[model samples]
Target chain A: MTDRDTTPAIEFRGVVKRFGDNTVLDGLDFTVAKGDRVTLIGPSGSGKTTILRLLMTLEESNGGLILIDGEPYTHEMRGGKRVAVPEKRRRQVRRRVGMVFQQFNLFPNMSVLENIIEAPVHVLGLSTAQAVVRAEELLEQVGLADKRDARCTQLSGGQQQRVAIARALAMDPEILLLDEVTSALDPEIVADVLGVLREVAETTDITMLIVTHEMQFARDVSNRVLMFDHGRIIEEAEPEVIFTAPREERTQQFLSAVLGEDTADRS
Target chain B: MSDNLQTLGDALPRLGDAVLVTLQLTLGGAALAFVLALLLGFGSRSHRGAVRVPSRVVVEFFRGTSLIVQMFWLFYVLPVFGFRLESLACGVLALGLNYGAYGAEVVRGSINSVPAGQWEASTALNLGHVHRLRRVIFPQAWALMIPMFTNLLIQLLKGSALATYILLHDLNYFTEQLRRSTQDTFFSFTFGLLVYFAIAYLLTLVMNALEVRAKNRLGAGPTLREVLRIAPVPATAKAGAA
Candidate 1:
């Protein structure tokens, strides 16, 4: 591969994560190229969310380096030796990555506008006026322009999730990690948030790593799709192939379970 | 009875002076207690043993000892060690520090009530530790904390009555003097009770109003009673119409 194609926006090499005795992510290896849209599909505890979180530096891996833009996030190497990066430097690195939570973790104390503008004004050192302007633009982009001044508590779940997406966008992050942004919304509200994400995928140069149960949405929006089970990516394919004819039994079982074919019709 | 009334009339002016001293001590002690409690509550959460251990010791020492004993120690024992304090100052200091230990628990409880996710969000945003506390944590803490803090303040107010034993001319002292001079023990002491009740009642009203205002501003959910009241009224009305 050429050097241009070789480099990825996010690369996880032999990543291992454990919570006491239980291993959540075991030797996970994956790469997302610059501006690529990738979605991870897996069972509930299949470690899809952990991969996204590790990229965002929300959790540290017990083993291996997570690289963003060809640099280690949790550690730095000096003279071919591994050393933990200082806390201050890790914070700087984190500014380049933004995440939208499944729970739509907007600051309940703040209005939608302030939620979007907080990091820009404080962490990025943008003036209030500048942050406000950028926030308005992102709000419009997320289709929450009408609700920008509304308190987060006043918004519906989907609107709040859109505001969360706008908040991440306001950071102008090179990579955005989305962990099931629509999963919490009402069925009717899910589309609105997904619509904004679709627009983002098309218009921006930002690389995206998404973990979603919305198979159709993922298949449509993602350039590549990965299927994970038991802390490993059991299958990786182009979106069409992943949706149509996945290789692994585990991937097929996961897809079938989410599609509601495996269980009896309870409803 | 008329002779008793005349004696009461003469004692009223002296009681007035004592009541003024009581107000000064109560308000001063309450303010100092609130400030100290806030400091100690935050200090107890410190990662370093240097900060946390001392604060814990201070809180435990004051809370375990009787307030009156603390007052006596401040007045008597501390003087022997060269920390001489006037009667009024000693009363305020002892009351403030003693009630402060109690108030610290309220502060800690309120701080804990703030969602853990709020702290995680601050850390995720790259906010520095101090900025995170000041900008993100403290405002929410203030809102969650007001009701409990107000209760502590009322307790501090009532607790200040204990200062009468230290020779500070507070409301309780005034009432005692009035009863002794006037021979109207029932009326004099009852009036002092009313005064304290009024002060404490006024504080509750203010704090309740503040709780409402803070809930509205912070978008903290509706009170359980408000939900219950509204919930039942609509359901009962619909049932009656049916």
Candidate 2:
């Protein structure tokens, strides 16, 4: 494909997810171009993480489709009919995607270095030497080079999270999904992890879809910000426009509550 | 009294043979139980009711029945229906089936204890079901399953002693013979009990040591060899310039 004709790295079209009677994603639609940085902001239960998870194919969408590199991820159109692709095909699609979890879901049984190299060595079929070389380099990038040999359980929350980011990057994915990655860390450590992410956003060409509560970080890092509430993107705009002059009433209330915390801390 | 004591004492050599027989039965039965349980546990993961319901039924049926009754059924009733198995084979089969059912639940629960994220993570890496299990899921499950499987093993060992009823000449059988000839119920039965206890305790100790070693190996970081193996090649300007 020509560079100009390259598809957006990720696209979600009218995606809907429901758990029993509760609908978490209500016909959500969005797109992120190659190498773009986007952040999703929302209150709890607003389906920000669900959107990331659906893109990762961790959870299947109940309706509509998620596309990766302009190809459907969860299903395929066979003879003009949407048919569920086999899990093997879905897995191949998933390899192009990577995610960092809010809980820092590093494999508890593996060391930090092993966690970083596991997908590369096993999934990507890279040589162990090559994978490890790449792993240590990414570890250096995340500022956790010294912690490579450490057990996952031994690292502090922030250190583990940094390692997790390195692990996701080791796969060299086209898209990286961060689901409130710093939300589970101590307040002091949150800055350290966010700093690493900010550095990644500056340095890497990978597209990022971040679900975050840190409004200031979202405003600074995001090219575009979408405000979600009860699933749909109620407001979407450039970060400057969304932060300074959101047109929607719901956006104003949400931003005010988040910004009020900063005012309290300063005063 | 002295003659009776001598008679009981002479049978001690035969008890060794019987003890060996018991060990063979127990180990064989336990090995079969482990494999069957793993299969059963994975089979239970099927989403369809047709597959899941029948597996659950089979697991519960074997688990609910007493080992003794099953042993008798295999030895007697199975032969009547033209399934003639040797007594030792019948004993091993019954023991495996009975304990296999119990072991299946342990396997199922241990596999389930693996976080949902691990599955998602494996899927993200493009590892299929067999590879997902062998490389990622089973190693972790193996760690958790060892302790419960050890407990099951002890039960299986105890169950092996029951084979004397089917005339397998295991430890209990020799003990019974010694008791009948010498009428030394106290010494004979007590000796038999002590042997059983000793075997059980030793097996548990070995299993515990294995559990510790497995956990250490799993938790152990890269070995020195692995670390060295991973060290990088220096970038050579001479080759690049050439």
Candidate 3:
């Protein structure tokens, strides 16, 4: 493929989302190029998670369009009118992306292996044998091969989140959305989840959009960081520059309020 | 006492047939009710008013009217409108409609109890609405619905006795015949009550087993062997003990 084929993996054009009277995302515009690992950092209710949710199609945008690989997925402009993309076309576009949640929402009725294999076999149309083989490889990669037959509820929270990562990867998505993945983990177990994610970032070219509170993990995995506040990207820069020497006043204030508290708590 | 024994012996075969008929009504009605419960329950949650409103109407209609009156109308009133059904059909239809309405609420509530994250996870996987509900939501919801369904099953069994009013020769009708012949109201009613209790207890055991199995499948409940503590001794250990 030529450079023309290298369209940004994800693009938002004045995207707007609101819940009743409360607007979560307002006229937002951003882009994540192919193979970019971008982390979004903000305080709660600052709309970082809403960005991921809108991308995953779990929530609909009230206004604006979302494009996957430069094609409309959520709303399309046709004949000078905006209409919802048909369900079949939406599914095709959505298959290019996968998401992991804050709650590690593995299918509780399924075993760890089944959880990973389900979407691959059902959505991707892989045969059971093929899906199982891929699932086992993912389970091993996540360091949970022994727990394949175990129920999702039987696993620890960290183990469950790892399985969720494996489940998302099983679909072989081009873009992976992580919404506060480590926020719910115990501090001791948080490192294990981050370790798996770091490995994925090092080994793969998957476009990752991460929303996290783990500053160090963000610094390690992301090439770019976007600081969000009140549904807007307040600052964007390289991880080192953003973390070490943010230019914006709000960015400086937010970093001090967050990192200052982190240092104080640790001491 | 000899005369009483003779009378009892004569009624035993008819009672056996009536018990079979009672079981037929209970089982057939239960199957129909379960299907209707799933349909109306999921339909009630539809985003469209057309689907949701009709489901609400059916659930309310059956739940509001008495089961006995519905049975009477089916058997008696329907004949005037050039529609006639067998007594057994009438009983099963009435029981199915009435109890299905109640079971629909259970299905709806249990589904609602599933965490919202589960739905989001399914959607994130690109699962279609049908696949998401079938593979993800329903299995978890099924475990929650079991206890409520068990309660409804027992109620349905007791209500089947009302079939006697529609001239269907179920267990209750046979009991009345035995009472008239023996002229012993106490023994006749006591026998019927004992039989009903036995059937209900058996159903409870069945439903308990199902609940355990469903919960265990989700890795939530104790397995059968663990609950019963039926671990087998090793051959070597058994030999040493012997």
Winner by TM-score: 3
Query: What tens digits encode model 2's per-residue C-alpha lDDT throughout B1-242?
Result: 78767886787688789888999899889888888798787777767788788778878999999899999999999989989999989888998898888998988998899888888777656666787787778778887888999999998998898898887999889888878887888877887898989999999988876676556445533333343466653343012211
Instruction: Name the better of 1 and 3 by lDDT.
Output: 3
Question: In model 3, which regions exceed 4 Å deviation?
Answer: A3-5, A264-267, B1-6, B228-242
- A63-90 per-residue lDDT for model 3 (tens digits): 8889989999899899988789988999
In order, what DockQ does each candidate have?
0.31, 0.23, 0.45
For model 3 chain B, the run of ten residues with the poorest summed lDDT: B233-242
Q: lDDT tens digits, residues A17-135, model 2? A: 99889999988888888888899887889998888888777887888778888878897668887677777778788888888988887776778888888889888999999999999
Backbone clash pairs for candidate 1 read none
Question: Whole-model Cα lDDT per candidate?
Answer: 0.81, 0.83, 0.90
Candidate 3 TM-score to native: 0.94
Q: Once model 1 is optimally superposed onto the true structure by TM-score, how far is the C-alpha of residue B172 displaced, in angstroms?
A: 1.2
The estimated TM-scores of all candidates read 0.89, 0.90, 0.94
By DockQ, rank the candidates, best first.
Answer: 3, 1, 2
Task: Estimate candidate 3's RMSD in Å.
Answer: 4.3
Point out the worst 10-residue segment of candidate 2 chain A by lDDT. Answer: A258-267
DockQ: which is higher, 1 or 3?
A: 3
